[model samples]
Target: MSPWNWSDLHLRDPWWLTAWLVVGYLGLRALRRRPGAAVFYSEVSLLRLLPRTAAQRVGRLLPWLRVLALALVVLALSRPRAGQEEFRIRRQGIAILMCLDRSGSMETPMSLGDTQMTRLDAVRHAFRLFVTGGGPLGGRPDDLLGLVTFTGYAEARCPLTLDHHALLELLDGVQVARRPPGLGGPLRPASPSGLTAGGGGELPEASIPSDPYWAEERLTAIGDAIVAAVDRLKDAPAKSRVIILFSDGEQTAGVVTPAEAAQAAKNLGIRIYTIGIEPNQATLREIAEITGGRAFTAADPQALQDVYREIDQLEKNPTEGRLYTQYRELYGYALWPAVGLIVLELVLSSTRFRTLP
Candidate 1:
């Protein structure tokens, strides 16, 4: 059998201890009393004459036995319990606000085997993996999630909520461009595939360069997005709040700088984790360092998935402690048993072991 463990074992009332002490003192006094001359006996003769029955033997020991049994009954009344009662514990879960760059640059087609997939497509795939229970992200149904998207201007796509299904659906519905034209940049064509001609000459496939005119509108507003996300989570009640920013490292449009936004988050006790979809280590490192968070570079879909998985682990296993408490009440008809034991002792003493005159 397994050993029993109890959270609480001490007596709740110190008066009960004093009462037990008094009872013990009285018992000792009773045992030490001298018999009167009228009740005195040369006991061997009388004891031999008595019937050798089990009831008689029990009667002889009844006084001390009754006292011991009463003590046990009183101790039971003190209500010893092996475990604590159930309580409603409030275990605070992590709050995460995902800030994704939806600038026109995200539409650039990256190769996936023979096919092509946009950066946005890769990001959405990673997000889907994160929201579904327990792979890399370790996201539980209980964790609160929020969403933000940024192009020229940052906007809250969804508020903080524990509704995972709704959040996933919202994420799926997010398209490349939700705002009007000329906001971020014009979509560029796929990169050309280099080929060798019959005469050893290089043949370049048709390709379109990203529009350079909207440099400010298309790339620079990431700081604004971070600031907006931080503002949204400022009054949140969770024990730990986090911001996961996904960007392509080109920042050209917002009023605030990434460093300033990171300072704002630090002031509000929010940690930021920046994931750069392209190979931009310098930008990623700056964002990570400024906000005291981690930076990950995802050059491919699998690497992006790994980054999200790491975020999930960080969320599930936070660096905080928790305390818990419990209580219980027990009730029964104790009066009857106490009275019955007293009466039984009295009857056995008078009838079964009565003294002769």
Candidate 2:
């Protein structure tokens, strides 16, 4: 909203509006001035009895027509214009990629101030609020957002997109890694004859869990996740490209180290904001500093949401939103009408409204 937007009539030359006083004074004089008598007679009682013709009725309005023309001319001189409308031309927004850890540690029970849930669930909730807007947080409607999840390996869950609904839907499906029962924990193998290895005794039964997909889900790969996010954001067509890395553990499995990935992002003019969930902050802080971003530690779900809010404040739209007003010149409208009225006054005064001096 701007000052000029307050009114629809924009006067380019407001000083000309003062001419209205002169026009009014001249109109008053014209109204008060009497025309000289065209003819004089000894007796004039017959003239009062004569019927008033249409020309005579029109003739009385001639002075008023002159005054109206002068008013229109004054309006034209003021250079009145119509404020068409106010609008804003918004520029492109920032591009952000969020990398989240899905390792077994993320499944630890956590409280979100009001309710208790897994750490992964709390992260999802906070992310939803950050994207869709909630109490104290404005949504990232103008930004292009993407997601990456990592454990032993990194996976690109979604590409950069403006459709937040789809992005959130994908985020809802991310879950903590569940290890297979027979694979990870302690295991006791019985002999082929159903006897203990040490002696001829009944072999203790072993409870073997039945899932194989947990191996990759049990280890954290912070560096690999950052590299994957950098790949997604390096070519993004935004002035400001950012990567938000969230992890509960240090880099446990990845070909490239976190520092190397951070250096790569810095080379491409990208920032990486690291958020640690009850983990050592030294590596996270180093990564953030390398990429010219910040590091945050979330002790609880509320603190995690607060970290996201702070990031939201830090990354505003790259382009500023500005309001502009466009005005359509209206002086032509007044000027033409003024000219027509003047011509009409001239014709009428020279003919039907004419009086002898």
Q: Could you tell me every candidate's TM-score relative to the true structure?
A: 0.56, 0.64
Q: Against the true structure, candidate 1 has what lDDT?
A: 0.69
lDDT of 2 by residue, 162-214 (tens): 99999999999988776554454543322324444355667434423234245
Backbone clash total, candidate 2? 2
The TM-score of predicted model 1 comes to 0.56
Q: Write the per-residue lDDT of candidate 1 for residues 1-357, one digit (tens) a residue.
A: 233355454434434444567568757765776445555566668766877888656655666656655665565566644435444545467788989887666777776567578888888878877876555454555668899988767889889888878887888777764334543433332211222213333433222223443323444467799899998888887878899999884555668878888889988889999998666547657777887889888887778888888887777734334454343322123334656777887887677676655
Cα deviation in Å at residue 347, candidate 2?
Answer: 19
RMSDs, each prediction? 10.1, 8.7
In candidate 1, stretches whose alpha carbon ends up further than 4 angstroms from where it belongs are: 1-77, 80-92, 108-118, 140-143, 178-220, 313-316, 319-330, 333-357
